[model samples]
Target: MRLRSIVLIAALPLAMLAQGRRNAPPETPSTKTPAELRAEYIREHYTKAEYQIPMRDGVKLFTAVYTPKDHSQKYPILLMRTPYTVGPYGSDNYAGRLGPASEKFMREGFIFANQDVRGKGRSEGTYMDIRPVNPNKRGPKDIDEPSDTYDTIDWLVKNIPDNNERVGMYGISYPGFYAAMGAVDAHPALKATSPQAPVINWFIGDDFHHNGVLFLAHAFNFFSGFGRNHPPDGPNRDRIEMKTPDAYDFHLRTGALANYDEKYFHGQTEFWKELTQNDTYNEFWKSRDLRQYVKNLKPAMMSVGGWFDAEDVFGPLNLYKSAEAQNPGAKNMLVEGPWSHGGWARPDGTALGNINFASNTSKFFQDDIEFPFFLFHLKGKGDGDKLPEAYVFETGRNEWHKFDAWPPKDAKWKTLYFHAGGKLNTAQPAEKAEAFDEYVSDPAKPVPFTPYIANGMSYPYMTDDQRFAASRPDVLVYETEPLESDVRVAGPLKASLFVSTTGTDSDWVVKLIDVFPGDTADPQPNPTNVHMGGYQMLVRGEPFRGKFRKGFDKPEPFVPGKMDQVAFDMPDVFHTFRTGHRIMVQVQSSWYPLGDRNPQKFMKIQDAKAEDFVKATERVYRTNSAPSSIQLSTID
Candidate 1:
């Protein structure tokens, strides 16, 4: 990639999205893929520079800046602070793919900056996981993401030549977490930021755990490489070789959680040990949760996430709500789409698995929402009115909705009660008063999150068909006959269950699904055996360790055969169950590998042995007195 050639490509806009977000789009696709265009544009128009920027704590963090060659005008600095390395460390070398953010910013012309936060990558300093914010900072000695960001911004405005003082911050996942923190006590130059898929709460709902159930596969696999506490020289890890392709076989054969830790991971992974030790939602975990300290937020902030994101979906929703509630009248916006983790930042978001969204959702969001947002705040190129308080995509229906507030003012709360004979309806449970559905959940045969065999957590499983599980005897399925008309759901969901276990402890896995018509046509450009017809698409599902039913901080053993009220919040929902589509709900005890087996015992899970694992008779009651139901907010 030559500089002259790169400059030519950058000067000439790419066939797709070269024109900013507002104008007409090409009817057909471009000859060059977006990735190709982005690469060429970066090589030609942008010159890379590596710097070791000093933070307030006097630690020099590694930073990379991509400056547009067109020096006719100064541009706003778009910064991303991440624990992920700032690679292509030299002036001659450039990143393989500059990520989705590059596509928009390259043509639009801005000073794109990517930095290695505190300790990871080529950066100097000790790295901490979800570094605790020093709420009562007295001096430059108290360091955190916000302080580091402030110091970085201060340096950039002072040191970087030919640049506007105005700055914008953005990142996905861990970087998103940094972006959110940067907005707090932001520098005068820091104007706005977007935290896409930020990790807000690990205990409540995030990557590490969800509702107190350890996402074993994700925790083990991710931490094996990412969770290490490297010496200043740095710690590098090779990707773990899989003993088997199927996680079920691997985890099951390992016998118990502690056995696997002792044999493979050992004490090498620091976070795993911390995770195992801090089993409850104690202050150690609470200190890292970002929601507690997101007050007096500076700058215009927009939190973005995917409705189907398996990891960190709870982040943007809760982060936005907290910021909004605490600092009302602030331009705290929210955008959720039909995406996986960071899916909106990709090229194609028209479909995932067998489902079709009927539009290039990724592009639509980048152009219509994200691009406009940065342009308005950073460059004053567009009116801020283009951005809304809440811009949510209506899945199933495949449309966009703008609201002054989420759960639109007219949204009505409706509870679909679980009834006998596997029926679900707005009508209260009218099954036999003494009726209950029972399934024997065995640790030996834990229910697979997906029927497919894979070593790691599958993001697609969030929307994967549940027909396999629904058919299993260990699982119970209930559904509405068929929707009378299109029912658009727009807000959070609540699962209220009356359950009992023969064992002292158990796990409850609930799934909300959409059953397609049996005659539904298969999606285009598809794979064989998709079975779109009669497919059961999972909309939202979560697992709760039965002990957490009391609270996350404390664990209570379930008395045998004693049915109790168990209710928890499902992340949130934004889907339409179209006319002729059946709304189904499934319940079971295990989602193996994805969620650790509960062992059905009262003992400490972190130290549980093979002998502790047992089979349990689980019962879901829909009796008149103890009706189990899921409450949803709908737009009529």
Candidate 2:
């Protein structure tokens, strides 16, 4: 692929500004004063200091605060609590305060605090798992990070002299989870916060279970990294060394994920042990979930997440909804951009895999939007404004839109039925018992998330390799009738299906896809003639596994012969399937290497031996009693 010039024209209408949150100020006229430039430079050149503060539990957590030296008055604080160590500063002396990565907020003279969570960095306290404010087990009410955060905020207010009595929080990935925790029962001093790419739902949404099936790569990688640093102890980064295998050959290596217990569990990883041991939905995971604890959310929040964020997308979206439902009075905003997991924090926002957004969308949001959000909330002297409750970057349209509530109020619940022979149609099949789609799901050979295999760290969500999946005989692809109008889906989605299998337990994956008609493969379209950055198509997709359909806890197995109606919730999407495009739904038994393979036997997931890797024939039943359908939030 040849490189285009760095200058890609900004496509959005300049006049369309200032519509959301009382129309933003006209793109701050390029400042051109010697004094003004000097002020901006100084604001971006603040010094950073490292310190360790003790929590109420007597745990000392490390923190790095970047304060403006020209501090004539008290300034509000912007804090980021993270497990990943916060790097101090750049090597170049004159290069200044924080790097360009933080140029937005730094240029606004706001105090930025980045601290390592307990059990990480120079912080003290035994690092347990992502312990929420409420523990699942019936034990002593042990203090968690939320308590630690309250203690830290209390200490900062009285001790840090040149500080206003206000603070805001935000972070990406794991740090995002901490930010969410910080808001559970936020400190009195905390006024505003944003949990970007936050871990809102653990088992069902975040790192592990997706729709019920365990996210194999994410799970294996995370455990390999964090599991190496087991509980009742501090974070041990040195113990977890990633094992490198050939990219394409990786699937073959991971025969039965349950076998991992025999290889690695030296009696230290009880969670990992429990994870593999309990493949069925049980009480073990329900307790660790954060969805139930998302009540009484304080701090006016701006929940940010990536539409393509492979790791924590479900968490942030679900978090925003839960917050809205639980605390309707609290101000909450959601900003979703076209980027990979925490990719916005990086410099370039190019194609994650085969799809490209045609611009550095991440940089645009960080510099133009996210920074201003903090400045407006934390500092009184911002652009004198506020952003809307939901500011989403629509992918297919290549534009931005805002609304008071998610799913936009006018969206309707539309169903796209699965037709015969891998066909997706709007009309339900007239014949009641013509046939069913059957596929044998072998635990030994499961479908990979991508065509090419790689480490878990590689961009998983950024890909267009449906060709490999389409080739698999086991996969079922159901598409919908071409839409007569533009259908906009913007909220939580659910897939209800009637299924049966020959084995006691089996996994079924339901995927919602946006199929775009392309020009015949032979002729290459002119580059200059490219309409909307050559993206003349829309292809959005999400999948959910079967067993955990009802919920993470209390998973009942297939009775070997009876039909089971399963409802799996698909992740939310803000898509506009245009007039010519079609909505699609693909049902299959496996999304593997990415997701751990289920044994079809209800035993422990991680401890299944080689003999437990049985090949089971799965059946999809579509009758009057067993109606399988895909439901979407469409434009009313």
Candidate 3:
């Protein structure tokens, strides 16, 4: 796991164990020249700047090279390619230097390089959102990410100094994705890579859609902030903003989902179009899969993620597995922490808004692990102290556990069957003819994610709080008996249920949670029960828009009231359901503004005319004929 800059920004003490390379000594007045001032401010930290680097197609990507200024000796080049501009010090500012972020990397006697990918930042080319794939029309598959990385590395190895000829790539979020892409056709000098919170796939496992349902808050927030029309080279823009740019709040106050979409999407939301058009696992998505590429990389790799990471827990886990299966020559490992999306690195690893994580996990990752890993790989020292295959934090017990592989060898795959009347046990269904639970999902009034926020951004992408829905009359809640011993669940979670809906089509949201018993001892001042004790909080949840259940790109109307088997794989999880904690699953029709309201009609979701939006009733059946159950990757 790596330290998140978000946490680093807030929690880092000015004098706390300074994990970075020692700051250069303060110079006397006469020694501080204008160049020194620029260096001190930025350039000195990053000592080299090389702007034009030609890729295979002759497209020159803008690159900023930062080298350790103090050491005249050669060093390994650490590369980071990003769509985000290789800022402040480009061609115009000829004196090559490191930005504050690259200073730490440069100090360790390694060449730090940040480049803009083909279409974004300073690079030349039209920016495509995550570079989506198209049918075989384009030229040379349009010089994909992998090729760009391959060309960049080839340029770095031959041109840079510190002649060891070894290189490593690392980045977080979008850049993290570039790191993964770099490993596909890795250069001989490319020895290692760490993809922190990378975007592996857009639909199946990203901030946008999961199990066919749209992740409304994250998707809309992302698009509105970093939409396609963003200028390729310009001043950094506000990627994260609290308020919506448009006057859609007026429509929201009107309390209508239809009106909001019409005004915001200009009646044409590409997001809506993408979601509805790709209802099944069609070629549109198949061409976009990076697993084939991820599986083939040879670089020694690490996948870092956070349990509470609202952004990308799914991508890391899937990348780890895919790489493990495909890249036999590489050493693969995963590090997960108790923090939120990209939480491992952030300071104040706490509950959203008011919650707190007892301790600062981010500091530990940066100082003790992340920094060291890069230092050792780039320098070829400290390799003897490399960690085990997996280092994970078990939340229930609140301790770190190391294993040779994920899911720990001793873990036994266990199954807890869903029984009648909100009962979950290992026993088979007792009733041969069990009835189904039904709920009405109104497109007008969908379920709110939490009790607090009205229409603000919700954390539904990560934690699955089902308490509000459990009490809802329309939802079906099934829970397992309190654990006799601490039960640890690791790896992907799948739910196979026999479901039916009354309308032409609808959606189902299934959530898996570790329910903490109510803590009656409330703490005052910090009242509002802020993290004081156990409350039925969510662990993980995923939604499946029913029409796309059969496939993501193809939409097929549901057979109303007919029992159809449905399944969705939850993001991988590592949790210890403590002795007294209960595991619960809730099935419902809508999760609202979290997922765009699914019109009960079967038509293409994007082309879903404003009038096509309708509410409908859905049912989940559990009987001998259709024994609905959730299959978890059991770790005994």
Candidate 4:
């Protein structure tokens, strides 16, 4: 019996190994979603704790702290301050999930903290949207996000038990705005930060508007929820009622921008009213911009954004550039992926729409960049150089790249000029042939931003096939032949258009696209319903409010039937027009509902009536004297 027992004991290791191998999960399939598994793991390992953390101005903010149950070692802090409600409402009620980046932070053992920004959610005080920093702040009573963050950090390090002296901060969008603000005049304990898709300047770019052009659907829906004043007991989910499912039809029927307040809002949303009132980059809008204030940043910062980000793509680029320009010595890193707004926060990052990034890009970012960043900076537990200076993912090619500087130091600037009969070429225009393409831009039948049917701003439309838009007579389509060589674009695309309008005012919407060949193949056994063949993938697009052509603050009326220069910079495109793909450009006067109609008359559009809307004949000149061309920052 003793000899049998010894033999069984010796066989135990082999038996366990064989059992583990037999029970292993399949490479292709999983019984549960990643989110479900992460949620379960977080709930089991962490405990929920709530508190009222006091800010510098004596404002007590509601905060939720999730600490690891294991007391084996002290953990560093990861903080996020947001206007978005951080609640399950009770001390015992834990969040469905915890941590800054997946369950990775929780699993790695960090004390995660989420706070309701002053005047938001359960926090005390009057809430302000994109709250401006007070550069001249002197007294303890004077406060802003930075001050609030400083006070919060001061309290956490001293009061919280089993905490290491280091701290890290991160958030997306509005919370991202807070993360940026916190980095300015950072707390001593605040050692690292990752502000993913931060809101930079609302008036110029990010969310509400782009280069002074109003984003109607995003602004309207967002203000109805986020911009409205909520009572202490009021729910935060109130949305503007869409009269019809068709956005283009609804906006056209709704008439002018005046209708939003008179019909639907009834003066309820204060910020919407404020937004309309300020049409230019006045002190009001400029003060709220975070770029000017992001100086002398002590935190080891990593600014993350997506190339196809529906919102805040401008933020990451501008913020990183600003820090480099303003505060030279600060450790500023940028990572831009081929993602929509906040796509990196989710589990699946393999592909979007018809495009396959070939790998789980988000997983790579979390595992390789984001987690390693804080772990090294705050915990001193990982390699410091894991995340590179400028780690950007190249679209079309679907590959990751690291650069010493952004816009790539070696990019060759080239112009893709428009020619007669919708041909876009790299050659210069003929000196004598001063030709122009004309299109009738009717406000009554304005161009839809996307072909799909949706109530609000469709984020997927950012990368959605532009084939539908190309078919429209109102939209002038220009394209190059299927590329002979892979032409990679590394920087911003600038549109230098010489346009004339029959009416006094108009808008110029320019789109840069990658036209996939009809014979091109999608991934094997395609996972998405999107047709990849002949897809005119919208790489980058932006609308320039024509009145702001001469200047943003100064309104200029276009001389009727006379050519005037309307040039503006479109967002940067870190994409490659593959060897078999064609490069395309689509130009139009109006993108309805996506942007408020121009009324085709040069008075204050915000106050224009239904009758003010008119059709206009717009001409885009493509000649040597006044050549309409798009300049790209091409990289070898």
- The Cα RMSD in angstroms, rounded to one decimal, for candidate 2 relative to the true structure is 7.9
Cα lDDT tens digits for candidate 3, 124-227:
76555566432242564357777778778888888876546788888888888888877776777787898888887877877677767766666666655454
Q: What lDDT tens digits, residue by residue, belong to model 4 across residues 1-636?
A: 232233365657887857855896544444766566666666777887889998877789998888888888999999999887887778777777776655567768899899998887789988888889989999989998889999999999998888998999999998988989889899999999888899999978788898888899888878777656565535665566786787777777778899888978888788898888898878898899888888888998999999888876799988888888987877899999988898888787887766778898988888888988888998887886666689999998899999988889999888999999899998878857658899999988888988788787887778888988888889999999988999999988899999999999889999999999997676688656567789999999999989898788788888899889999998888999999899999999888688878888998878888889889999999888888999999999
Candidate 1: worst 10 consecutive residues by lDDT?
230-239
Tell me the tens digit of each residue's lDDT in model 2 across 1-636.
001111122333555432432554433445465345544464445666767888765678887777777668888887788766565333222223342254556655677777777876667776666765654423333477777788788877777768997998887777777878888777988887778888765566676766566776677667765656533224455353446654324645646665565555465566676666655555656655666776777777777888878777787788888888888777777888777887777777755654556678778877777777777777755661467778887666666787878868887887766667767666666666635777888777776666554766356444343645766878776765666878777776778878888887777776666656553232234443332321223244444555555666666667886677777667777777767676666677776666777778876566666787788887776555565788887764
User: Candidate 2 regions off by >4 Å?
Assistant: 1-44, 87-102, 134-142, 227-248, 264-271, 277-284, 383-385, 457-463, 481-484, 520-545
What TM-score does structure 2 among the candidates reach? Answer: 0.84
The regions of model 1 sitting more than 4 angstroms off are 1-37, 96-102, 229-236, 430-433
* Alpha-carbon lDDT of model 4: 0.85
Task: Give lDDT per model, in order.
Answer: 0.85, 0.67, 0.68, 0.85
All models, RMSD in angstroms: 4.5, 7.9, 6.3, 4.6
lDDT of 1 by residue, 1-636 (tens): 433444565666565435543475534545776567667767878888888999887899888888888889998898998886777577788875553453666777888788988878888888788888888888878888889999999999888877999999989998999999998888989888999999888888999899999898888778767755443334545445556788878888877778866877767776778887788899998888888787877789989999988887899999999998888888899999999889998878997766788998889888888888888998998776567799999989899889989868788999999887899998877655667899999999999999788788888888898899999999999999978899888898899999999999999988999999999987665665687899999999999888888899988999999998789999888999999999999999999889988889987888898889999999999977889999998887
Candidate 1: global Cα-lDDT? 0.85
Worst 10 residues of 3 by lDDT: 245-254
* Cand. 2 Cα-lDDT: 0.67
Q: Cα lDDT for residue 331, model 1? A: 84
